[model samples]
Target: MRRLRPEPLTPEAFAPFGTVIEADPASAIGINAGFTTRFHALAEVEVEGGAPILSIFRGRPRPLVIDMLERHPSGTQAFVPLGGRPWLAVCAQAPGAPLRAFLARGDQGAQYARGAWHFPLLTLAAQDFLVVDRAAPERNVELADLAEPAQVALDG
Candidate 1:
């Protein structure tokens, strides 16, 4: 097994794989008497020919181990945390390419581009998330098993 430590999530570092959705009052359009701020169009959502589906996912914390990776070739997938808890994201350029790990806070979210290989949701604590993706009739997942699993580590 290989050990890997995740780096802090930033818009620049995550740009290659997808967009980093963050709330910035400076970049937001104020509405409702300036009481609320909205960061609009934070991600490039692609659904191909399928319809977009909104779903909620509750994930339990688990050890960071990448035994396999999966990808969606038909559409882009986004995950936003509903609860204020930090999480981890692992992604790669392709099925067998080198992997990169990112640490995201509760307020941050990510949208992965089509065909980008990634691991499933990972959290240090249990958390709920809003997931948006394409709903297609055919299978859209492409999975690959790694010969050597990658163990994820986090630093303060």
Candidate 2:
């Protein structure tokens, strides 16, 4: 098997899945810093369900990686990144069609496109993050056990 050196996370590359999870400060107001706002509503994007749409995705800081992988016994696999800066990575699928990544300076939170592949979560200097993405729920669902516990990473 080949190992992918972590690249910058982008929605273009992770399009096979879903939208990259991003947190707009303007949308963040009363969120508890020490608390988690559980996701009760099935947070989802209905538009990009057919084609791929990869781009920047961000979210809040949590100690764990989100459920962003589906066992699509068929089709391609997608991956995103999770960190406080601009970063891109091909976490799951084979890198090709030429993949690219980048991160904004001083950003924050952990992100995972519904089924986007990504390195668990990273806080190089602080609890900030960005997530790469992709998804195909119809093909598979996350199980109590890691369906594919792959080790994801990055450098620089």
Model 2 lDDT tens row, 42-156: 2243223443345543443443232243333222232233443443332344222222233323432223344444333333334323222344455333423233333333433
Q: Candidate 1: which stretches are off by over 4 Å? A: none
lDDT of 1 by residue, 1-156 (tens): 787889888999998888887896557887899998888778877988789899999989987889899989999999999898889889988766788999999899998888888998888788898999999889888899987789997754
lDDT of 2 at 41: 23
Best by TM-score: 1
Query: Candidate 2 — worst ten consecutive residues by lDDT sum?
Result: 94-103
Model 2 stretches astray by more than 4 angstroms: 1-3, 21-90, 93-105, 108-111, 128-156
Q: Give the TM-score of candidate 1.
A: 0.94
